[model samples]
Target: MTSTPSLPDPAGAGQPIVLPANGTTVAAEDLQARFVHAADANADMTIDASQVENVGQAMLQLLVAARAHAQAEGLHFAINAPSEAFLARVAACRLGEPLGLEMEKEREQ
Candidate 1:
């Protein structure tokens, strides 16, 4: 008897992130490290949420913090490739507009 794994509902609970093959993964550890690097280098960073899943509340906080850090340094911050599921989370949490996530990037632009 084999049990199948369940796909977590985006609204059900928080899930850990799966880093993408390219681009920086915005998981907890990376979020912290990136924040420091940006602070030291005074550069803005983008988070690609399209290939990301299993997002938890902590991850969201990290993004918020990153934006704040960038703003403090007068840097430009942006989010690209946010999946619908992830976008829903931001809307549900009322953070989409504040985060400046216009919407997910369209393919074949």
Candidate 2:
């Protein structure tokens, strides 16, 4: 017997989706749907990366795209309370500025 992973309901604007520990290609589709829903709502979109321990290019790309969509729509988008692993991964990919990781670090100071 096989079971399909359940799709998550779209989180309301300003509400964050706490990312799972694995932010890999397998998770990109679900994440994309959530971002699309948030964009369609025409409100702020926030993602909590506090639980992200392992991340991949697909996830990072998805986040960048989501942020761009929010910006183009004149809505706020933020990634809150990111874990060290998440931070390092963004930096390693040279996406700190685009992903707002650099700004987030400054805010913590």
* Top TM-score prediction, candidate number: 2
Per-residue lDDT value at 12 in model 2: 54
Quantify all predictions' global Cα lDDT against the true fold.
0.61, 0.80
- Shift of residue 36 alpha carbon in model 1, Å: 1.6
lDDT of 2 by residue, 2-54 (tens): 99995444565347877889987979877778878777667577889999999
Worst 10 residues of 2 by lDDT: 6-15
At residue 20, give the lDDT of candidate 1. Answer: 45
Give each prediction's root-mean-square deviation over alpha carbons.
Answer: 13.5, 6.0
Model 1 off-target regions past 4 Å? 1-26, 103-109
The superposed Cα distance between candidate 2 and the true structure at residue 59, in angstroms, equals 0.4
Clashes of 1: 1
Q: Write the per-residue lDDT of candidate 1 for residues 36-97, one digit (tens) a residue.
A: 66556666566667865456666777778877877878987777777766776777776775
Q: What is the TM-score of each candidate against the true structure?
A: 0.64, 0.81
What overall lDDT, based on C-alpha atoms, would model 1 receive against the true structure? 0.61
